[model samples]
Target: MYFSGLVSFLIKYNHLLLLLLSLEFMALSLYYGLFLFLSMMDYEFFFSMLFLVLSVSEGVLGLGILVMMVRSHGNDYLMSFSFLW
Candidate 1:
């Protein structure tokens, strides 16, 4: 199925949320991959968990910045950045 114009627009403009979601997808995929590899090779899972935690923390921080900016400016457009200074 293809996304409609509104979905595409959201993905284009809501970059921070999009990035966070992408990171979450990556982290989940990596965990699954690591689990499969470990089942085959017999290694510990701590490293994969660590990476997942780091990605989550990064997403949290990124979303926090996005929320703060939106709260301050009342807009999510890139043009709002000019008001930063």
Candidate 2:
């Protein structure tokens, strides 16, 4: 699932929304794997909780950036932004 998300992220680079979605998908897969591993090993869930918190913050930051990009450029297309500008 993570690999699929990565592939999509790379292939769908034309849209910032798709890239963000792919990143969220990858984060989710990682969280699930971490939770399962910790549970099976009988370890504490503190680490998983920390990871979840960090991921949520990262997602919020991504969305904020997306909103700003869309507002400034009127769209979420990645190719619309030129580095040489």
Candidate 3:
């Protein structure tokens, strides 16, 4: 419910790029928070590095998808994806 609400809010007022960015921010924050918690327990940076690497890869993939979406739709608005549903 919370995530759906966030998606709706992002769709209603944000550009597609902004939507992707916000998603990325949310993911990174969650991962980094975990990493910090883990670090405090054992001072290990490995988990954070692993998550950072993963997040970057996820970012690249998301960006590639965004590019494809824009090319196919010619616009970056959430409403433009109505055809998908």
Name the candidate that leads on TM-score.
Answer: 2
TM-score of 1: 0.64
> If scored against the real structure, what TM-score would every candidate get?
0.64, 0.94, 0.69
What TM-score quantifies how close candidate 2 is to the native fold?
Answer: 0.94
Whole-model Cα lDDT of every candidate shown, in order: 0.67, 0.92, 0.74
lDDT, model 2: 0.92
The per-prediction CA RMSD against the true structure, in angstroms, equals 5.4, 1.4, 3.9
Q: How do all the candidates rank in terms of lDDT, highest first? A: 2, 3, 1
**Tens-digit lDDT track of model 3 for 1-85:** 3365467546655476776676677776677678769877887787778888887998899789879888998878766688755
- Cα lDDT for residue 30, model 3? 76
Q: Candidate 3 versus the native: TM-score?
A: 0.69
Model 3 C-alpha RMSD to native: 3.9
Alpha carbon lDDT of residue 40, candidate 3? 76
lDDT of 1: 0.67
lDDT of 3 at 56: 90
- Best prediction by lDDT: 2
Worst 10 residues of 1 by lDDT: 1-10
